[model samples]
Target: MTSAILVSILMTLVAASTPILLAALGELVVEKSGVLNLGVEGMMLCGAVAGFAVAFSTGSTGLGLVAAAIAGIATAMVFAVLTLSLTANQVATGLALTIFGVGASSLIGAGFVGKTITRLGPVFPESLSGHPWLRAVFGHDIVVYLSLALVFGVGFFLRRTRAGLILRAVGENDASAHAIGYPVIAIRYGAIAFGGALAGLGGAYFSLALTPMWADRLTAGRGWIALALVVFAAWKPGRLLLGAYLFGAVMTLELQAKAAGVTWLAPELLATAPYLATIAVLTMMSLGRKTGRLDAPACLGKPFSAS
Candidate 1:
């Protein structure tokens, strides 16, 4: 491929990866706090539709993003209340949340179907953003850069900070953490809220940046991929970043194939590649887990009561 073509592909990969990376990072924190939320897909949908609605209605992508975050938080709180407060089954609750999200988004977004808006713009001025070679470094929008910054930020927060240590302690042994004066339940609530907010932003990236339009299930199943990415990265932020891009490359194969005018493979088959890759990657992770040190937080998905 020509250098220009390569640059274009690279840019596309970054944009494709940003939403998954954003959602995975939020989930990493949520899992680290001993909660396994499977409703990430639901949260993303809520964010996507809300973000699109606000942006289309107000003519402000920024406001749309804010709305998306709020929607995500609201949806996540439902899961939180069930799993954390009522001490409901985490797995079932998560599944229910996803169902609720689909219905809620469909109902709330019914009026927004088929609408379009201006796509999010690059943060840097055109001079830098449009530079032939420098575009690789400067061409992305604010959310793209924010996702990169969050990768390091999450890694730092999990590994280097006192609060991180405490969160880890909670994940490792919530009863102990609670006995030691840390508020296990409260910390978890904060973690869940944070994850929901990021998941919302990730969903917003789809409506406001990637497609710049409203569609039912606009996020598709990227949320599930984000969930797998957490395990694929062994819950490490750095690995999650790399994994997101790898999956992003897989996801963009359809576009690349069409661009190359390869007629042998059907576009439908190419479209399935990313989901197939997700299944394959997850299978490998499961098999590898049999031999490796268990990397999962011990208390993940377990309920805690102050009894």
Candidate 2:
């Protein structure tokens, strides 16, 4: 019984972390290219509302996912124009974009509050599902699998690809890369859009698959956690997966404790465990900077002027 319970807890952790992992993966790539996008929260919210609205209207989860990605990309384009083209301050523009997204999503999703949809379940083969251990480990909705694949894909791309090398070079020293003929602004724009799309997909997953319902602020700061995860992982994709699952497990455990009537912990504290843990991790990382160098792109969050 204890083993079964533990397995269930682990399963819940993976399920809860999928969305964060997806958003973080995209942000990792964008940051790798020296672009700082703080609008992930807004993008995710937009995705959630757009996805819910579309799924409810068309009665197709697939279309809803597509719509969410498109919305995210559109929102990101606004940021791209501001920061990349107009050379606006990246941090300020990103925060403004989030503000816009939050307001826009709230207004757009006003009618969708409290509405629910029939969610599409996991799509693993029956053979995989039949195995108890494999089912616990591998059986999940399509988005979960995609998130895992993206971790590996991003890791490989950053480590092995020439294009990725160029991206890194641009991030590390934009002026040097520009002198050598790399299109820094163009690359950053594309990476920002990609990040937005991924954030949107994560939001869509929350609405169309995870909760299958509409709620204002449904993402609920998951975007901020994802941003922290990127920093915690030191911009490494492999470590991002570990950090995401750890946070996810903490969140699931809090809910389980509440469900199991654990009398030792206050309900509010349990509910706040995830955020508290995030704060603790960030504090530790900040204090431990001397032990290892945290490698951020040299040009990250800086405006570049093309001569």
- Which stretches of model 2 miss by more than 4 angstroms? 125-133, 291-293
Q: Would you give me the overall lDDT of model 2?
A: 0.87
Tell me the whole-model lDDT of each prediction, alpha carbons only: 0.92, 0.87
What range of 10 consecutive residues in model 1 has the weakest lDDT sum? Answer: 285-294
Candidate 1 — which pairs collide?
none
What digit string (tens of lDDT, one per residue) describes model 1 on residues 105-176? 899889988878999999999999999879999999999999999999999999999999999999989999
Off by over 4 Å in 1: 289-293
Against the true structure, what is each candidate's TM-score?
0.97, 0.95
Q: Judge candidate 1 at residue 107 and give its lDDT.
A: 94
After the best TM-score superposition of candidate 1, give how far the Cα of residue 88 lies from its true spot, in angstroms: 0.7
